[model samples]
Target: MNGIDITVSTRLIQGLTNLSLGHVIMILVGGVLIYLAIAKEYEPVLLLPIGIGAILANIPVTGMTEPDGVFGILYNIGIKNELFPLLIFIGVGAMCDFGPLLERPYTVLLGAAAQFGIFGTLMLATLMGFKINDAAAIGIIGSADGPTSIYVAAALAPDLLAPIAVAAYSYMSLVPIIQPPIIKALTTEAERAVPMPYTNNQPVSKWLKIVFPIVVTLVCGLIAPLSAPLIGMLMLGNLLREAGVVPRLSNTAQNELINIVTLFLGLTIGSTMTAGKFLQWETLGILGMGLVAFALDTVAGLSFGKALSILTRGKVNPLIGACGISAFPMSARVISRLGLEANPNNFLIMHAMASNTAGQIGSVMAGGAILALLAR
Candidate 1:
């Protein structure tokens, strides 16, 4: 009887001791993520799943995130193989509406200009002692193009994926707060109040819409084969939307497919945030560099906008230029709101979108360029 009691006690003690310090750290990280999601409302859809995954993975003796466990299986099946990011691209493509950009082809340049953040941040990171490839990966977080950031980071600096992704999404959510001050500071009251004529006459034909995605895929792929997967998937999603006969497919890709994959992707990414790998000096550096990249992108884009405003004889609002950071409709909306505040009649949404979309495509191109330049 005493032997039985001793055996049970020994098993309990071994179980308690088996709880590793790494698990404890992971739990704390999970708690932080939870607080950010719940209290801070930071990308709750993704962060909530991520936080839960972190907690689950860190639970001692759960084995849920180990090589043979459930989360591990999911991670190996998707993230490890780069399946999740590409799949998520399809969803992104389906949901994106290129009408505003297509109507104003000139906006493409704005998108390209906004990409300055990626390259600029890359250089800064390299100067700060990061490896060329890792620096390039970290720099992409400023693009505000989440998938592109993920795709590049996964390929070049998979180890830094968690922090890079968190930073990218977090900053993206904060665009409303971050961009407004910069836009207001850079543009004069007159510049912000400038009224631009609206145009509804630009008609994008179905043929051009169809051709747009195909052309972009070919051009980007030809330029950087490494970006082929990302560009290809994105274009495919766009193609489905433009094809005009695949409403069902487009709906599924945009909603159901995206929702399901987001859950898995978020959790798998969170699993990578194990304490040993994430709690490091380099992670903090990446975060700092990401902010630098975002600030520079806004500055470069606004400078260009200011130049355009001067050249266009005040026909262009410099505030619209700040939308070039690729935060999608959010940046565009912020510009429009500020425009209204400066002049109640000013509607910069459409104009801002041109630059906003341009920032998106430009960000991807820049990502490819960085990959080409550094990954080789």
Candidate 2:
């Protein structure tokens, strides 16, 4: 009996001795991600699965993440090959309605202007000692465009992709909390209340809608070939949506396909967040810089909006500038709410949508530009 007890104790000691600190830290990080997803409602669709994957990846005996594990297979199939991001873009494009942007082509500039955050943040990160490629990856987080951030980060700084993606999605969801204060500070109550008359002057032709995605894809591809895969997939999805003859295909892209791919993407991303990689001083710094990037983006967008107001002789509500952060209809809705608060009679949703959609396209172009500049 004593001999048996001694053998059992030896085995337990050996097991404990094999445990790695990195694994423990990763498990804790996974727990934190799960809590954030469930309690804070922070990108639950992605974060929850990612959190689970992180937990699974860090288990001591599970060499699953090492060579033959399910996650290892997933990582190889989707992420390493760059299949998932492109697939997700298909869904994003299919779901996106370009009508708002098409109705006011001028608003595309607002989107373009908002991309200042990505480049500006890149320069700032470089000043902070990050290499150019790493800075570019980190900077894209400010665009509040999750997939584009993921694409750029994966291409330029795969090591930093996990944290950058988390930060981008987190900030995107928090747009309501983040943007209002900036908007209020920049514009007085009267400026927020300024109501612009909506003109039904432009009707988006079906042909225009069909051609818009194709033209953008061609133009962006010619300028930044690296972005072609992302842009092509995105445009293909949009074409399906606008063609009016592929409801089934569009529905699959928007629903079943997207749902399936998001699961794999989230899990694969989480697998990359092992404690060995994530529990570093650089991770904290990246988080901090991400917030700075977000704030600067809001400043740039709102400042441009203020300038547009001046250009339009105050007919344009400067508050709509905050919508240029690419948080989509949420940012637009926030602008409309603030406008109503300042003056119950004011409605800026349509105008805000124009800038909001513009921000989306602008973010993609900015991501492409950064890839072109840095990947070289």
Candidate 3:
């Protein structure tokens, strides 16, 4: 005590001593996230790291998120600069097989229809008293794409980032549970039993595959210049994968690059979940609107599918429409399962996948549209 000041209430020595009710609640929230990842096996890759980050950030004096700290460095490098989501999109494009969407071009309509959720939720948010930009950020959760939600929120409503990210990723993880009941309630048993066989198993030519990504990038960029960052990165990754000239780069993008970005992104996003920011009326509103957006996406998709089925005189399975919500393989598999349950031999995976992938593209484009409008 002769040479140094010793304060009993200093944060460094007061971890548990300074624990408040808010900190306790945040700790439990972090535990719940970890439990969901481990026990329920829900989005384990992202959730586990985010859960740990949440605990670390909420600790009284860890300084993990201080300006010079690890979390802060990660946030500035990744989330604040808007690099992580684009990086993840590269991986997504690398892993994507667009042949299905190419084969069934009409399914693009389902993808387009599903995007109504984004706009619908935006309007609702405005009515609920959110600022226009914040509403735009919150509504993008309807895209059902975590990266897109993050990208848009980072630009339009950085303050709402934590709740929006949590809501978007959580709903994406629960796609299997949330989609089925809504699908069942929307479709007739007979509609579910209808078969839409996929006879096109032909491989796309290497030249067409190479050209596709380039064409898509140009078209999306021309139509929505604001979307170029997101869409251009996505198509660049796909082009690398399909060009047959950069297998090494494509492989790196899909695996190591994506994985590293994911880890840092999760931790940085979780840092924003400190109790003071997360437990607010706005957070609740975002969570609620996020659910509404998801439901509307599903309903809209199913409605479009039903109409297509009627137009085609039962040759098309209405269930495939429900796959057009950007949930990718999960939504595709759900529709396929429902088809099989209705008729043991009813094979609809290819059909559903066609729409699912298109929905992915549609979501990117929708995010671009929102960005474009907000820019003006």
- Model 2 TM-score? 0.93
Q: Looking at model 1, how many pairs of residues clash?
A: 2
RMSD of each: 2.1, 2.5, 1.6
TM-score for candidate 1, residues paired by index: 0.93
**Considering summed lDDT, which 10 consecutive residues are worst modelled in model 1?**
10-19
Q: What's each prediction's TM-score?
A: 0.93, 0.93, 0.96
Per-residue C-alpha lDDT of model 3 across residues 1-376, encoded as one tens digit per residue: 7335556446447898878888888878888989998999888778878888888889987888887899988888889889999999999999888887778879878888888889999999999999999999989999999999999999999989988998898899999998999989988888899978767778767788788889889998999988898989999899989988889999999999889988888888888888889988899999999988988899988888889988988788888888888987888999999999999999998888889988888899999999989944
Indicate whether candidate 1 or candidate 2 has the larger lDDT.
Answer: 2
Residue 8 CA displacement from its true place in model 1, Å = 5.6
As a TM-score, model 3 comes out at 0.96
lDDT of 1 by residue, 6-65 (tens): 988977787467778877887888888889999999888788888888887777666787
Q: What is the Å distance of residue 98 in model 3 from its true position?
A: 0.5
Clashes of each: 2, 0, 0
